[model samples]
Target chain A: SQELEQSPQSLIVQEGKNLTINCTSSKTLYGLYWYKQKYGEGLIFLMMLQKGGEEKSHEKITAKLDEKKQQSSLHITASQPSHAGIYLCGARRNRDDKIIFGKGTRLHILP
Target chain B: SQTIHQWPATLVQPVGSPLSLECTVEGTSNPNLYWYRQAAGRGLQLLFYSVGIGQISSEVPQNLSASRPQDRQFILSSKKLLLSDSGFYLCACSPSGYNEKLFFGSGTQLSVL
Candidate 1:
């Protein structure tokens, strides 16, 4: 079975600082997804990366898939209180395979 | 316009009680459906998934079971609830074929006492 490990299980940063969360997979990744969840709420889709060396960004957040396809990172530029939440990384071994998620990185922003 | 609906926003039941959680998708046909559980301070665990009507796959053996009686409806059930079953239950859907971006529901917070 494939597994995903996220670094910095929990993080605390100043509201205007930048931070990056990393997700590493034990197996090659066919697809990688990033999602954000506020406490007690369902996950909100952020972005998806399929091809190696691919990078995508939305607003102040950016995600990139490594050339090896086994690692991905989510970076938040000038984080705000709204960026404080649990960020999870999900991956699939194949296009039709089931997706598995990481334990998630809890982000806390100090105003 | 794809949307996934899951209910009983919250549930509280005693041990040995029966349990059922329902999920439905609208504005899409033959979409892949899935049920996942998120334990406290843990990641989302895939419980069950279905590709089409009457087709179901279990990811881990537990006190729970799943059924897909309708094309867009998926149900998670348990004959007797267990304390370990308490978690945030989420239902998700994705378009058929290559697109695997999942749309999730508001989720059900199940507490088995």
Candidate 2:
């Protein structure tokens, strides 16, 4: 079975600081997705990456899929208190396969 | 412009009690529906998925079952709940296509005592 391992399970950063969260897969990924969730709320779609070496950005958040298609990184520039939440990375092995998610990185932005 | 609606933002049930959670998708028809459970420290686990009415695929063997009675309605049920079943339940939907992104519902926090 393929699994995604996220690094830095929890991170606390001061406002205006930059941070990066990583998601690595045990097998090749057909597609990778980034989502954000506020406490006790549903997940909001952030970005999706397909094709090796793909990168996408929305606002101050940027997501990148490595050339190998087995790793991805989400970076936040000039973090804000509003950015405090859980960031989840999900992936699928095939275009029609079920997407599985990582445990998620708990981010806390200090004001 | 698809949206998923899941009911019972929170729930508490005793062991052996029956459980039912409902999910409906609006703004779309014949979408793929899924049920995912997020246990503490256990990421999101795929419980069930359905591609069409009266069709369901179980991802794992558990104390739960899912039904798709209508094109846009998905339901998760259990004959008797267990303590280990306590977790955050999320309902999601995606268009029937390759490499489509999933839209999630607000989710239900289930606590089995």
Candidate 3:
């Protein structure tokens, strides 16, 4: 079984629309990270959430960790063409050095 | 600020050919280094990690091997490449701490024929 699960394997939205991506973990999350990967490129760090019930936002994107610390959600507002890319959620298990990633959500924006 | 450089950005080789991919970190000392491979439509798979010079921990058994010859350098090598080795290879580093955030390199796209 996969340790991490991401919903909506792929998403397509129109420009200026809003969308949300979700990540769920089977175990307790000690650290959660969100990254964006453009086509044929490395991942770009978006946000990191540690504590339960924590939420962080940068620009139009906001990531929140649930109170149970087992799930996270990333919401993007007024999506633009540049927001079209792959969004990946990674989680660290209790005290582990390695991060486990989900299969990623491929997001596309129509201009 | 720390940055990771991985090269060559893309590579192509025939089956049974030798392979070497290099990654180096700058502006950081004693950082934890890692190698990961992503197959098409799959998530990242941890291949190897190093805590310090001459130390390596393999997460899986495969045709590839990793070495840390210097504090900031990590190399991934294969005695004989296989067609299954074609994928996107990424190098990542984290500050020396448990559950730290990883910074990834630009990645190498490998095509084995």
Name the top lDDT candidate.
2
Q: How close is candidate 3 to the true structure, as a TM-score?
A: 0.97
Give the local distance difference test score of model 1: 0.94
Write candidate 3's Cα lDDT for A1-111 as tens digits: 238899889999999999999999877888999999997788889999999999999999999999999999999999999999999999888766588788899999998
- B3-106 per-residue lDDT for model 2 (tens digits): 88899999999999999999999999889999999989898899999999999999999999999999999999999999999999999999987579999999
Candidate 3 residues lying further than 4 Å off, grouped into runs, are: none
- In model 1, where do residues sit more than 4 Å from their true spots? none
Better of 1 and 3 by lDDT: 1
In terms of TM-score, the best-performing candidate is 2
What is the lDDT for A51 in model 1?
94
Candidate 2 chain A, poorest ten consecutive residues by summed lDDT: A91-100
Candidate 2 Cα misplacement greater than 4 A, ranges:
none
Better of 1 and 2 by lDDT: 2
Candidate 3 DockQ vs. native: 0.73
- Superposition error at B36 for model 2 (Å): 0.3
Tens-digit per-residue lDDT, B1-113, candidate 3: 78999999999999999999999999889999999998887787889999999999999889999999999999999999999999999999988776678899999999999
The digit string of per-residue lDDT tens for model 1 on B1-113 reads: 78888999999999999999999999999999999999977789999999999999999999999999999999999999999999999999888975578889999999998
Model 1: residue B43 alpha-carbon error in angstroms: 1.1
Report the C-alpha lDDT of model 2 over A1-111, residue by residue, as the tens digit: 799999889999999999999999979999999999998889999999998999998999999999999999999999999999999999999977999999999999988
RMSD of 2: 0.7
